[model samples]
Target: MVFQNISTNTKLYVRKGNINIEVKKKATGDRIRRSLGLEDTLSNQALALSIQNLIEKDLSINAFDASLDKYIDKCIKVTETPDDLINLTSLWHKYIEFKRKYWSPTTYANSGLVFAKRFSKLKNQDLRFPQKIQQELFENFSLDAVKRSCIQIKAAINWGLQERIISNVKWTIPNKAFEQLLKRQKEENDINPFSNQERDRIIEAFKTDCFAREKGRHSQYYFAIHFWFLTGCRTGELLGLQWQDIKAGYLTFCRVRSQTNVGEVTKNSLKQQHSRKFPINQQLSNLLVSIPKSKDYVFVNKVGKPISFSSLITCWKRVLSCLQIEYKRPYQCRHTFITDCLKTGKLSPSEVAKLVGTSPAMIYKHYLGAPENIDVPEL
Candidate 1:
């Protein structure tokens, strides 16, 4: 290829064999060319003169030879800023904008966006200070919360590096800190399943309470509690249940309803995506048969909508208060069921996992230590 001065203005030409390629010099083009130690001038005549000087110098050297395209690329690299050197916040914003199209609103709020806001002050800082941010988060938040934040931050950083929006660096929580956080979570979340006596008291209280039985009042509260205790379904899964989900002798857990800041949203699949059939016991089957199916849902409030989780918890608290029983989350019904199933010795850990749309590892890890042995001899 041979460089040829075609015009006294901002245009030049390179002849490759019979083809002449025209190259225009814009302000950006001139800057790039200058950064590559080539000619850059205000007027086209001056720029042409500078190019002529370069050509004469190259001829004199008889060693330096490169195509105009290759020289332009080299100039671009010289003038462009490396992605890794961009501010941390700028990279996170790019990541967040990209993720907004793909992630659910609730997930974005709960994970990436939330982490972004928490560390907004450090947005202008470099990603090299990830360890410092991790330490700060661990000190300020609960172990679980910290773990979640770290995961989001790490994911965002990894994505930025992968997309070449930021530099690759070690942005992981230290192994020791992560292990300590896991230990704290395990210690804090130690399963506290209700005993058989406590379970009996709760059921009996709910059944006999006048407030629960009040005509045209929270009557569904009574049945809802019973349904939860009977099925051991997650509160959201039980509330999400529809009349159509009930088959002849089993119920299909295919969806879950969770309340978020905006409103309630129904996920089409259960947590862990482990939707399964839960066989209805004789008592529960009888109870289902007796209830009037006035709405699409198996359980509904007075306004004919699926019962809210808060309402269920309020009813449970009232019942617990009436019975003078100690407070336990409504979720303990699930633990109670798993413990009862394990005590019966009729179902294996894997079987219980299938029944509740959970993992066998979870069942054994949490419930196997104290199986309800009804046959144990009295002291």
Candidate 2:
């Protein structure tokens, strides 16, 4: 049953299936006071009009309905109440908290928290406003910063849309702007792998140098460098490897150790979830056999703990300095190995990808060059 009181300025009270709901009238002075619990000394009309303006600004509602429960549900669905307005900062925090369950500590700290903090300064801004977002991007951020911020902002907004905390809206970086960023990145990025001669020189230095041959720290550095060049495994994967992962002729890359802001953390799976077995060559086998298996990890530090990527990099830099080789990051070892494998012509592109735990498409796009020997048909 539904009925309205003329004295109460069209306020409707409905009762259906034992549910009673009171639908507010046209936000009158007394109604505003009841809703707000304001002091009696204030001008009721002025306060009511002020509240009406806020309601008009924040909410979109149809005319008052006879069904009070339906009206209340509709109000809950839309931004009809002050509490219903989505706070961008709050939503971002919620998104980050939700993502922590799935994302690694490094990812959560670097991407999720970084974006949340960046956007939190604009606390109450409506993320649905594209112009405001664009203004924020330009005013306070550089081009590179804008690109990174956009990635996180877009992800958070997509999550909000999926969770129904945000209204569906077109939020995207324009194609032209993104293209410019890509151009900038391409200009900045340089992928240079060591040549065969350079690889040989580096290896020889690691093997023969008196400092590298010394008992404790030097031995660990030498072994790590040789293993990296021979196996083409990522530094994290190599550090994460356990003695049990090594079998008769192959080593399984099933886990990774990454350095997060907190410290080093071990993940049970590799990047891309592509665990693969790499065959051990003579050099690698000899190195493994010489080292004592005192710890679960194949590679460890002075205290018998897993060595970090940063520490490995320090050792690599020292070796490079001693040999006077042109500076290259340790990751170049992976690239060098891939290039050498491709140049040999013994392994196909698919085989290289399988060994490396990546896709054939990646090998073709990034590592493989033109064929050296294409059979010509006799005409």
Candidate 3:
């Protein structure tokens, strides 16, 4: 076989009757040679030249490792394989870049930031081995973190597959695995709703700003704190509420305002739904009617700005601590509402779910059933 020089640093020659391409890195003075495993025919010569051209292009950008790995990966066959065209980290960055424009700044900060940081732990790992990812998530992260990271990883992988950045394989974590992860998370972070007595005392404390260094008794955010329990709105949704949302004995929830790295961003929908409307009962109506409509927002701070969740959290913690009530997150306000509704036996899980912008499955799974309180009839 005749030896041929394709470029200054690359040459194709025959070794043992098979075509081989050799590359010499000028900067590192390193020599690399790969066998094309083709016979010394005219067709094989053409293929060798083509491969040489690709290597030259990749070497220009100092990406020899990536370039050669992809070529070799394509040539090989195995039961399970690693994709060298893109790794898990690169896929996540590309997927997030493609999705950034579609996501709200808040969504990007809350989800995009967290997922990106956590995924970095699996640096340069191929997406083909989902079990490795599952193991890392379960062993290294908290149960809730593991669940959320798994969800984000799966979403990014699905996007990568659709975009052709990932090779088609059994790369997805199975549904049973996800269900088990969720079960473990639920066990770790079970819903601990405040009892009716505890709920009432907490509300009263917030209303009076009890144990506050600066007292604004029933003046600052009393209505909002009360509203959280009565309507089961999320803290971000309550902060995003406008007076226009209330009309005709119903409140429309279609926006969320939350802090992000950039700043506060407004999303035109609930976290999971596009919108949800909560009916106003007599008690809810009284609370809404009594609050003065001086500001655009139905709930605002003493200085007439949208209430910050951080401030709300500080107040909630203070009230719970001072009142000697067991500490539950402010989010438990929603749990208490859901539990109370389910306990009444009047509202079905689906009805309660719609009112709270959640799923019936979530209601049934987290909230304990009323039968725990009711006496069983003798058979």
> What are the models' TM-scores?
0.68, 0.67, 0.68
Q: What are the clashing pairs of model 3?
A: none
Weakest lDDT window of 10 consecutive positions for candidate 1: 40-49
Give the range of the ten consecutive residues with the poorest summed lDDT in model 3.
72-81
**For model 2, how does the per-residue alpha-carbon lDDT over 48-138 read when each residue is reduced to its tens digit?**
2223323443334534334333323432232232324565555666577677779875576556645654664442357667668767777
Runs in model 2 lying further than 4 Å from the true structure: 1-87, 104-106, 120-145, 168-170, 184-189, 207-218, 370-379
TM-score of 2: 0.67
Q: What global local distance difference test value does model 1 have?
A: 0.63
**CA RMSD, predictions in order:** 19.4, 17.3, 15.5
Kindly indicate the candidate among 2 and 3 with the higher lDDT.
3
* After superposition, candidate 3 runs with Cα above 4 Å error: 1-85, 121-139, 168-175, 181-189, 217-219, 368-374, 377-379
- The Cα RMSD in angstroms, rounded to one decimal, for candidate 2 relative to the true structure is 17.3
lDDT of 2: 0.62
Predictions in order: lDDT: 0.63, 0.62, 0.72
User: Candidate 1 residues 1-379, lDDT tens each?
Assistant: 1223333323343332222223333322431222223332111212233333343344356532334544344323322545757544445555766787786645544454445445543322456777677667667777777777667677777887788777657676754677774774463365567777888777666666655756545466667777777889997788888988999988898887887533566777777774778888899898888777866777887677777888778878877777777788888898888888888889999999888888898777677674573357789
Q: Using lDDT, give the best candidate's number.
A: 3
